[model samples]
Target: MFCASVEQMKSIDRRAITQYGIPGVVLMENAGRGVVTVIEKSFAVGRGAEVLVVCGVGNNGGDGMVVCRHLLRRGASPRCFLVGKKSRMKGDAKTNLHILEKCGIDVVEIEDRIPRQFTRSLGRSVLVVDALFGTGFRGKLKGCALEVVERINRSRLPVVSIDCPSGLNVDTGCVDGSCVEATATVTMCVPKVGLVFYPGRRWVGELWVVDIGVPEQAIAEEGMLTSLLESHDIHMPPRDPAGHKTTFGWVAIVAGSSGLTGAGAMASLACLRCGAGMATLCLPESLNAALEAKLTEVMTYPLPETDAKTLSLNALELMAPVLKKADVVAVGPGLSTHPETEQLVRSLIEKVDLPMVVDADGLNALSGKLRILRRRKAATILTPHPGEMARLTKMGVPEIMANKPGVATRFAGENRVTTVLKGAPTIIASPKGEVLINSTGSSALATAGSGDVLTGVIAGLLAQGLSSTDAAATGVFLHGLAGDIMAERRTEYGVIATDLLESIPEAIELVLGSERGFFEGGVRRVL
Candidate 1:
């Protein structure tokens, strides 16, 4: 599903109303009705269920009014509270306020503060509908609006936010002050970027995108660059039944050192586990025996090593035949930043003709030499956590974290390489400027050697003929799914990176499962 920014969404909404002739009120009604549908199905809202609909003076408030009317029609008791001045309401919002009053549903206006009676009402309410803000909302929650949002949160009721959780910066997901921590957000038209990005994503529990009658052409014409990766987007290429080892794909892994041999082993093993036909661990000549003993199914090639036992600059010449035979190269995991080794990495990055997945030390080698990326002819994927990203771009961690999608997108576009910005929700950006936000994984993935496993996954997928973007996106989703599965089995605290390896196949199967369903046309559940 396409993830739109505030301006793009506004433009899409405008084009839908003006070009496609969709009435604004009809769209508001659809949005409100969609929220009601979610409340009914997700929360089991039924007759006599007391729902507190906290509305503002904007169209968001109008959406809340529609919710109240729908709840009343369903025999549910809904108390509507307007957080701003009723007179300030305009257009569809003003029309909805008058409609609510005519239907005998009293609209309590709170101009200064939330009365003590509102607190008592909160105790009686089964759910709180947060229509006090929308995607256009920015800055902090202040005045009576902040009070109402605080009380709703303190009430501990299942709150459903309309469009966005009040106080959220829909573009950046940064909350300046207090923001409503919703149980679910029923975003209209398309999922917003902030809803998928961090800090803002934390507040949005289950995300359900609802179609508010926006034209498909309007969205397409908008040319949204970012999209939330859905299960359907992961297409595992079919295996040739008669294909042998080399036919599947061969991953030549140039990684490992004396102490960090596990990184290379994990990368090579993950390649095989993720269905790569072969994975050759090309490492320091001295450490080959130990790695050979550890990785039973993986092949080991001893290469010339520096005094520190890291890949020496001499290995670059030896890699010619390895690159000649391999389908893809997985570089950087645990490869120490020894002077000669770093030089070797930079050399291979500039000279290698095969597609590569660069991670850990490999990214470090390119820190001051990123210009080399622009010269590469084949596809290159850089999987960097925020710290690595900061070093590569010479930006602070906070700045990069502030806008992961934007940072990743810019880096990929500038260097013409696929970038996987690894974080809570990984952002995959391609050289073509397309971005994919991964939807799987949990805190359980915060483990050592996890990224090494990811490097292998992507390299394996690339070897299997997946495009750079597809490989990175698919690998990330599957890697996170594996972490999720382990988290479910052993809790987040107990799972490690190696644990994710065993679950990769299961994760792949789960995503490829037949039980998946779409919410509606042009509207899909993104969480």
Candidate 2:
């Protein structure tokens, strides 16, 4: 599904209203009705339940007015609490608030401060509808608005935030000060960016992106985009029965060190698990035995190793013969970020002709030298969490996490490389200005070596002949699906990177099950 940022939605709204001649208030009514439909499906406003509709002085609260009217019509004695005074409400909100008075539903207007006992009365309320702010809000909540959010949060009440949870940066996904902790957030039109990233994600319990009768072409015109990749936006890898192992492709991985052989092992294993026809690991002669003992499916080549058990200058010379055949190259995963290693990484990045998936120490090698991304002959996919992304982009982790999709999309397009900014809602950006978000994975993936596994997954996909964009997008999706399965079998905290890998086959089977006939041939699994 496509996700449009707030700015795009506004432009589209203007186009529909001014150009197409659709009344703005009519569209708002459609949006409010959609929210009611969603709320009805997810929750039950118990018989005579005290429903509190907390509204601000805006169009979003006008939506709350519609909710109150619907509930009162349902025989529920609901109370309407206008956050601002009656004099402040205008336009449609004023019309709806006045209509509430006519309908005999009491409208209690809070002047300057929210009474201490106001939200406390929420002890008996089954639900609280949050209509404080909309997607246009940039910064944070404050004063009475801020206090009301805190009070509602302290009450442990089930809140249903309209459009988006109040006080979230709709474009960047940042929550500056305070936001409503909603039981579920009902997003109108396309989902805002804040619903997917960290702190905003924390406030929004469950997310449902509802359409409000807007045409798909609206986004096509504005050109603003959000990265929320769904299943349809991907290209599946082709499987030909007439092909040999070489037809799929080969991956040459440069990883492993004296004490860090495990990183290499995980990377190689991930490539094999991701369906690579072959994964060749070029390691220093000293670390060969250890890596060999740890990996089975991956072929190993001995390169020059220094006395320190790391890649030497001679190793770069030896890689000349094998680099020509590799479809994908993995530079660093556990190879320590030493000065000598940085030189080796820079040389390989410049020399390698195949697409590269750089991770861990490989990313560290180029922290201060990000311009190296522009000098690459082949496609480059950099997988970095907020911290590593911060180092590469020269921005803080907070900044990267807040505007992750923007940062990743900007850097990837600027440097002509694909970037996978890893986090909740992992963003995959291609240089062509296309962005895809992975809406999968579990918190259990927060453990060590998980990134090595991820690097492997993407490399393996690249080796299996997927495009740089498809490989990165598919790799992150499958990686997260594996984590989700692992989390289901073993709780979030119990799932490790190895557990993530172990769950891949089942995840693949589950996904492949969706497109059964092609993969299953003439037969089918009864289950």
Candidate 3:
């Protein structure tokens, strides 16, 4: 589904109201009702539970006002706290405030100081509805509003924020200052970009996207390119029952050295686990014994090795014939950055005609010579962490991380290759400007050798007739899902790369066997 920025969301809302003829008040009513539904189902609020609705003077506040009316109808007593002066509310918000008063619901307008009664109300409430800000908000909260937000957070009551957490920057996912730590957020129309990205993600606990009468045509007309990858987005082709081993693609992995043989073995094993029909690990001849002993299912090809026990330039000839039989080539896991090895990597990159997933030291070898990516004939996928992407783009790590989607998209567009910028909320960008923000993964994936498993998963998918874009997108999602599964079974701190690899089948099963999509806490019926 498309993840919208503040401007995109505003444009979509405006278009829906103006051209599509959907009333703004009706939209606000839908948003409010949807939030109340989530509250009723998730929190189980009823007559005995009191809801404290903290609202601002904006439309987001209007939505909160509507929520108060809905809660009253549902046999719940909702205390509405208006942070600013009552007269400050205008338009739909003003209308809703009047409607709340007409319904005999209590509306506490806090102008200068927070009333002691409001604090008591917060203490007695079962849930806090935070409708202080919307997507358009920026900067820090100050004055009475700041006090109210801080007090609400300290109250330890479960908060359900409307649209977004009050202090989050919707576009960049940055928190300038004090932001509401919501227990759940009911975003309207579609999920905002910030909620899925980090920093802001920490504050947006459980997320639910609600339909607020915004026409699908209006959102589609905005031409939003960025999207959050959900389980429904994954599409894997069915295997032919009559087909043999050769029916699925063959993957040739050029990785590892004497000491880094484990990296190559992991990548090769991940390929087979991801459904690649055949996988061959081509590494330094000296590491064959160790790799062969470690990997039983994957075939091993010993290449010419240098004195340092890394693949030498002479191995390129042997790899050329191997590439001719392979459907895809994955290079650069565990390969040391020795001068000769770097040279060999550069040569193989330019010479290999097969679709490739280049990662690890392979990215390091191409640091200054990124022009070689533009010269490749077949599809080239560069899987880089922030440090590697920084080296490739000649920018600092912080800069690359701050604007990962932009950096990955720009690099992919300029180099004419697919770019999988690896990090939390991993970004997969196609040369055509299509970008997918992965919605799976956890801190457990921070462990070593995890990226090698990812590289192998992408290569395995590529070998199975997936395009570079689809392969990378699918691989990253499955890799993260595997990590998530591992994190659940074993604690996040204890999860290793092998654990992630072991869970790949279960992850694939979860993706294929189930019809649900990802939510904040776990898989739920798609909203």
Candidate 4:
């Protein structure tokens, strides 16, 4: 699903109105009707339902006015509260407000504080429509708007925010102050970046996008590069019916040290579970015996080890034959930060020509040596959490987290490698600056060795002829979906990394079987 920033949405709106000759008021009516559609379908609002419509003196409030008109037509009573001066409303909003006034509806205008009847209004209302702000909203809610949002949140009523939740910064997902916690958000056209990222996502309980008379050409003309990865976007490589073990893919993984041998075992096993035909786990000589016993189906190769029992710099030459025959290579999982091992990782990154999935210490090895990414001829995928990204970019965690898409896009564009910025919602960026926001997983994925499993999944897909971007996006989505399934069966706290390895096939099956997509219906529900 295509997603837009606030400015991009504004441009699309302009193109629809000016270029396509779509009337502004007609778009407002479409938006308001879309909100009603969600309310009727999702909330089951029927006749005689008392709804509260809180609106600001802007185009957003104009939408609320239109909603009031529609609700009245549907035999529901809607009390409209104007949070700003009525004189400030202009354009299509002013026209809608005027139409509501002509219908003998009393629009309560509030400038500063909540009136005495505000509590009584809340007591009688079943649903609250927050049309006080749209995607253009920035900073924090102040004065009466702040109080109104706080009261609406405390009421525990299901809220349907128009366009976006009031007080949300659409550009950054950050909420600086009082923001409405809506039960659902009915966004116009495409989703805003804020609705898909961070704390803002928490405020948006359920997200639904509605077409507000915006033409497809208008949207396509914007040339948006960012997209929300939905179920229908996932495409698995076709399985050959008569294929053998060697026909699928051969993944070579170099991981593990003395005490972290489980990392290598988990990564290699995850590769096979993700449908890789075969896998050979190469670890330090001392750790090979342990992994061989633990991983039954996976093959193991013993590489040269340092004093600390991690893959040593001397192992670089030894991996030549192993890598030469492998379709893809996964490095870093439990490879320790011993100076020799780090050196080995750098050398492999610079010398290896095969597609690579780098994670954990492998990413750590590139902290100050990111220029090596530009020297590689083959595809490279880097999976880094915020802290790891901080180290790789030489930026603070807060800085990277503040603007994940921008940071990931910039890095991928400059380094010419696919970058996966892992977090609550993983962001996958292509070398050409396209960004895909993964919309799966829960806190269940916050377990040890989880990233190792992720590395294996991506490498497994890459070996099967998936592009670096597709492999990262699909891998992150499936990995998160696996985590979600595990969370359902074992609870979020009980799910571990090994549990995810077992759930990969289940996630793939679910995605392949899902029929959900952008159907003919005007509204599309997005999680």
CA lDDT scores, all candidates in order: 0.91, 0.79, 0.89, 0.91
How far residue 49's Cα lies from its native spot in candidate 2, in Å, is 2.4
lDDT of 4: 0.91
Whole-model alpha-carbon lDDT for candidate 3: 0.89
Q: After superposition, how far is residue 92 of candidate 4 from its true place, in Å?
A: 1.0
lDDT of 3 by residue, 86-162 (tens): 88989888989999999998788888898998989998999999999888888888998889889988989899999
Per-residue CA lDDT of candidate 1, range 361-416, in tens? Answer: 99999998999999999999999999999999999999999889889999999999
Hey, what RMSD does candidate 2 come out at? 5.0
Candidate 2 residue lDDT tens string, 25-123: 677766666666666667787668888888888888888887788787777767788778778878877788788789987777766887644655577
How big is the positional error of residue 505 in model 4, measured in Å on the Cα after superposition? 0.9
User: What is the TM-score (0 to 1) of candidate 2?
Assistant: 0.90
Q: State TM-scores per candidate.
A: 0.97, 0.90, 0.97, 0.97
RMSD of each: 1.5, 5.0, 2.1, 1.4
In model 1, state the lDDT of residue 183. 98
List model 4 lDDT by residue over 1-527, tens digit each. 89999999999999999999999999999999988888888886779989999999999999999999989999998999999889999999999999999987789988867986677888899999999988888777898999999999999999999988999988887899789998999999999998999888989889999988798889999999999999889878779999988788999998999889989899998888888999999899988777888989999999899989999898989888888889999999999999999999999999988999999999999989988999999999999999999999989999998899999999999999999999978999999989999989999999999999999999998888898998999999999999999999999999999999889999999999987576335787888
Clashes of each: 0, 2, 0, 0
